[model samples]
Target: MKPKTYFLCTVVFLASVAADASLSLAFDKAKLDTFLTTNACKYCDLSEADLSGRELRGADLENAKLGSVKLSGADLSALPMEKRTKRTNLESANLRGADLTNANLANAAASGAYLREADLTGADLSGADLSSANLKDANLTDAKLDGAKLDGAKFCGTVMPDGSKNDEGCAP
Candidate 1:
């Protein structure tokens, strides 16, 4: 092979390796398993996990790293107050770019969660405590947000449930 061709091949190989390594580090398998089995995985790395269609009711995911996670159609709602272990706690969790389309977040305590750019289309967020959550650029089209508490929540460039665009906190 020509010297130039060899060097280019080496660089491409290295770049592919680096990309694979980064993908492997995206999430912890043990942590994802624990969360799936027990519905609780606080303070763990679950970024980029494909948890679609999982029953995650009342999950305790406080401070979890869920960036780019795929939780479409997952249930994140709390049980009846008497039988509940706790509300779905996404407080301070990093859920940026997460795909939560059609997920059930009713009665969840998601205060301070980072949901920027998350797709919440058709999600049931009724009664959720989203106080202080960062929802900039998020899509909530057709989502049911009845009774949801949005005190201090950021809505820059967010798509509202009623099909309206919200730039309430966006910079001019």
Candidate 2:
């Protein structure tokens, strides 16, 4: 890991430990509102939020913490061809243990993202950039992942896009 990333993770862990027990794991209401209104929330903490079935295509969420967030059936895919500017940026975002069942994440830029143990059953992740992402133990049954960038991605115990179990990146 990069030094910066390591530092950030350490800081976040320390902060979570130092904070009050109740508020540390909750999503920030103000940040959530900002993201809902603007569709852009870099480095925001949206973890543990219930955002199922929301229209969030092309949202810019780089480095955001979405761990344990309920995004089942949400649309976080690419925008239409004519009206498009950029793809959804999930780079380095934390999506660990998220519920993304049937979510549309097609063509999103998710390089270096963390998605450990996420439930992604039937999610559409076609053409997305997943380079160096950690998908350990993630469930991708029936997911559409054609043309996705899988370079350097970790997939230990991951349920593949084709509904197969993959232990390619597992450690002994």
Candidate 3:
């Protein structure tokens, strides 16, 4: 191979290796598992990972950074049915079609996130920040949304299941 070609290839390889190393150092499955099992819901960083179609019931991920993560079709119904709550920093995360029935997400920051077709039946979302979120075709039956922020959020074709549109805290 030419010297120039070899040098370019080496640089690319090193850059890829460095990126992988950084990702591995940042997120580890064993540590996440330990935190999940213990329900220690606070300050977990799970950014830019593929968690699509996984079961994460009762996982304490409060304040976790889940930006650019693919959680499409994941089942999040393992949270407490009565006190259903969220503690994660899901800003700009993709959660399309995820089941979050009876989940409590009071004060959760879900701004600019993609939640199209996600199920959030009877969920508590008081004081949650859902600005600029895509909630197309999402189910929010009997969900509580007192004091929630939906500024610039898209709710195209979203169903309430009970046939009631969300008027509480919605800005016109």
Candidate 4:
């Protein structure tokens, strides 16, 4: 009821809010790391988290938001290529040594993502946007590219899904 008491209560409330926010951030970070290490968070909210070198084999990550997250060297082979939307959002994310065989990535956005030495065999990339993605030494054997956009997508020693080389403007 007193003015001094009210002021002290307000300060305490503000300090508590700040502390709560910090704690929440810390907890989210810790949880993310734990999930990556243990491979527990299959369908969790991993939006905007750093997941480089994570082993997500056979994980159910359907409809997961990974906008602007770093997933360099993350093993995504565990995902079932058929009957699933392995269509990940890896814009500017590192994808070295990743396996994306037979994945349905139709209409996915992967501009500027590093995909050196990655495998994309039999993947359905129809109508997908792969601008500026590094395909150095990557395999795309038998992958679908019908109506797909490949503006500036590098193809250094890349293998097409149809057992052919992926030169610029080559249609199946």
Q: Pick the candidate with the highest TM-score.
A: 1
User: Can you write out model 4's per-residue Cα lDDT over 43-89, one digit (the tens) per residue?
Assistant: 34555565555555544343343333444455544244667755445
lDDT of 4 at 37: 74
| Best of the two (1, 3) by TM-score | 1
Ten contiguous residues minimizing lDDT sum, candidate 2? 16-25
- What 10-residue stretch in candidate 1 is worst by lDDT? 78-87
Superposition error at 31 for model 1 (Å)? 1.5
**Candidates' C-alpha lDDT:** 0.92, 0.93, 0.65, 0.64
TM-score of 1: 0.88
Candidate 3 global TM-score:
0.51
| Pairs that collide, model 3 | 62-87, 84-103, 84-104, 85-104, 86-104
Worst lDDT run of 10 residues, candidate 4, spans: 59-68
Quickly count the clashes in candidate 4. 9
Q: For model 4, what is the error of residue 141's alpha carbon versus the real structure, in angstroms, after optimal superposition? A: 0.5
- What alpha-carbon RMSD in Å does predicted model 4 have with respect to the real structure? 11.4
